[model samples]
Target: MKKDSKSLYYKDYLKLDELLSSQSPRSKELGKEAHDETLFIIVHQVYELWFKLFLHELDFILKLFREKEVDESNIGRGVESLNRILEIQQLSIRQIRLLETMTALNFLEFRDLLFPASGFQSVQFRMIENKLGLDENMRLKYGSSSYKMPLAKPDASEVTKTEKEPSLFKLVEAWLERTPFLEFKNFFFWDQYSEAVNNMLAEDKRHISENPNLSADEKTFHLKEYASTEANFEAILNEDAHHVLVREGHRRLSHKATQAALLIFLYRDHPILHLPFKFLSKLIDLDESLTAWRQQHALLAQRMIGTKIGTGGTTGNVYLSKAAETHKVFTDFANLSTYLIPRSALPDLPENIVKNLGFYYSPESDES
Candidate 1:
């Protein structure tokens, strides 16, 4: 048992007095206070607090991936951090529902007091986005200017600095590229996987051509659709084609990294791969949760203002909607499902490789 030298009071420990006193709404300062203004200020302040927590968790996860060889236990811990982030993101979306409790008419009571101070000015949120590897070039312009144009010089500079750092996406990609099982002696994962995919595609084509239920026109249409899907598989199988997609901004993950992720998804049952698979899945979950939050925020703004400009001089919900559509980080991981084959269709690994992938123990025999 351990005892503190000094007794700690809850109020003093949390600085509750300072926290409770920080919510002075602009409407209140203007001599005529609006009731909803207090709620507005509190909600935004709470959002900033959650943003801070996101950065804290992200910093830990980033550190794990930055190592030359991340341990399996560290990956498990990273997955746990991602799970916390996803839970907080869900709460953030629910918090929007709470904000919606104030009607549009009520919001108007104090909305005018918040001029030129947009959510775009949230430096911490921007840092979170950058740390997660949201490509700055892909960001939608904020009212004919860069997203950082709305921020104060110091905040903008801080965001600019964060963009230069290696994000979780980059580090994870590097880690995946270093994965060992992609090639094991005489067994090459890509060769086996590609052959299986071709067999599946050939079966699909035969089915489409021979189906009695489909008319000639329907068969033609289906074959065209099948060809498109087959081309997608081809792009991944061909390194040059994959590189072309990367050059054109259609894909973000490098070819080796993409293959490694697919290997993880396809062979997730392997004991050694289970944690890596979970880690990758959690990244996709985090991206999805953020996208949901952004979409929910956009809807809330649309409901509150109805096509009006934002107090920060942006185009209100339109910009928000566009950002929601494009600001995704781990979509490549999610899209790996496109190439997944059934466990039954997967190639069998060599005995040596299987032993490496598994956790097994056998007592040795001794002869006298």
Candidate 2:
């Protein structure tokens, strides 16, 4: 049995005195002391705290992926971290409901006092975005200036540092590219998968053309849409096409990584790939949760201010809506569903490959 050398109190341990005193509503400072301003400040402060925790979990995941060879156990741990992150993101989205509780008129009571200081100025949020692999080039400008324009010198500098670092997206792509099962001896997963895709597309086209209920124009329209889907599948099947899409900013994942990710998705039932599949799924969930939060925030802003500009001088909800549409990071993983064949159509793996992908007991080894 052991006790701490120095006794600790809950308030002291958590610095509750400092944390509780940090919420200084601008309305109060300006002598109006709006009742809802305190809630407004607390909501944003809580968001920043969650953003900090996000960075902590991301840093751990990033470290694991940075290694030359990430152990399966580490991938499991990374999946656990991502699960926690997804939970936090869901909570963040829910918190917007609390903000919505304040009426537009109530928000305006203290909103004017928050001039030139919008949620756009949150440095930690920017860091989180950077760490998650949001491309700098893809960011929307803040009223003709860079998004970093509103941050203080030190905060901007920290964000710049994070931008240069390898993001979770980059690390995961590298890890996927390094996946060994994509090509095992005579079994080339993509070769088989590509054939399956072509067969599936042909079947779809046949079904569309043979539909007895469809008119000529309806068949034409459906055929045109099917052609576009075929082209999308071709982009992944052809390395040069995939690269062209990457150069055009239509895709973020590299060709090999995309293929490996596809393999993981198609064969997620394999024991060895279960963790990787879960990890990738969580990443998609994380991206989706953030998008959901952004969408909710945009709605909240529009509800609070109508078409008015944000206190930070931006176009408010318009800017947030655009960012939500474009800020996604793991969409490629989600879009892999486009290429997935039914289990009935999936290519059977060689016995040896299946053995490698599953855990098996060996009585002889145990006897030794």
Candidate 3:
């Protein structure tokens, strides 16, 4: 064999040296930090690894969404990715609790050692939000000294070439714009769903027109209404394809993605989709869990560091509590359902079953 190029070895290949050297202990006595500081560092590293997986899944799902053949099958992939994302989130929740096991007394040993560090700077977490189409203007953060994202920005907006593009949300928003109006309108609950979406879009447009401070990107999004549908819209649902997407989306590995989409789809469709509330109950459970996690995190911080400012530069427990409160799950949608269900006729069920089944909505019945 020809001699390997000198660059092919350690220099050009794996940067193992740099990677291994990244973990720098603050004190000479590495083992002296109480309450498993090594475990703390390792756990955070592991969390980042999971977030990386989420980013991968999100990218793949969004790509599927963009294809011209977008349907339940493609959407299912997004759902599966979502499910995997949820698994990672569950692990994160558990990891968060690991902090509770250690008292502030124990943390004090390594408190000073952990100079400027907090989960606030998690780039991968931001990537997940971007992929899901959450607001990104204030969300994106890089070093104040540097103008560009160290990693590629998923969305391209910044003038500075040094700044990487923005996140996948930009791409998803564009994809939504390109999506054929007929195809989106063909889903089971087309009319009402389209109405809700249009309403939201209309509101967005008004806000854009009136608001002086709206960013250029926000204005562009509001001005261009990509999806348009009439109130009496009726289109063929590719039953086979739809089922395939639903099944794929519901795959255990992609629960969160599926859940998020389904939540949106159901709300848009309203009484039309008529999916079993039992199916939605799972999402409700997840919402409860997320809320609980936030509560616990706030408590843990309060107990550990008291009223001190966080390493992330905010009032520790107070800031954390507000962050937790912001994650309200399903309050708006749940409220909306009260109006939708009673106005429509109930689905056929066994006499006894019908009598016992409390007022509930099922998405499955919307199939037409």
Clashes of each: 0, 0, 24
Overall lDDT per candidate, in order of appearance: 0.88, 0.87, 0.49
Model 3 misplacement above 4 A: 1-23, 29-35, 136-292, 327-338, 342-368
The residue pairs that clash in candidate 1, if any, are: none
> Model 1 has how many clashing residue pairs?
0
Residue 20 shift from truth in candidate 2, angstroms: 1.4
TM-score per candidate: 0.93, 0.91, 0.52
- Looking at model 3, report the run of 10 residues with the lowest lDDT sum: 229-238
Relative to the unseen true structure, what is the C-alpha lDDT of residue 186 in candidate 3, on a scale of 0 to 100?
33
TM-score ranking of the models: 1, 2, 3
Task: Report the lDDT tens digits of candidate 1 across residue range 226-284.
Answer: 99899989999999999999999999999999998998898888777788899999999
> If both were scored by TM-score, which would come out higher, candidate 1 or candidate 3?
1
Residue-level lDDT for 171 in candidate 3: 40
- How much is the lDDT of residue 50 in candidate 2? 94
Q: Rank order by lDDT, top first? A: 1, 2, 3
lDDT over C-alpha atoms for residue 91 of model 1 = 88
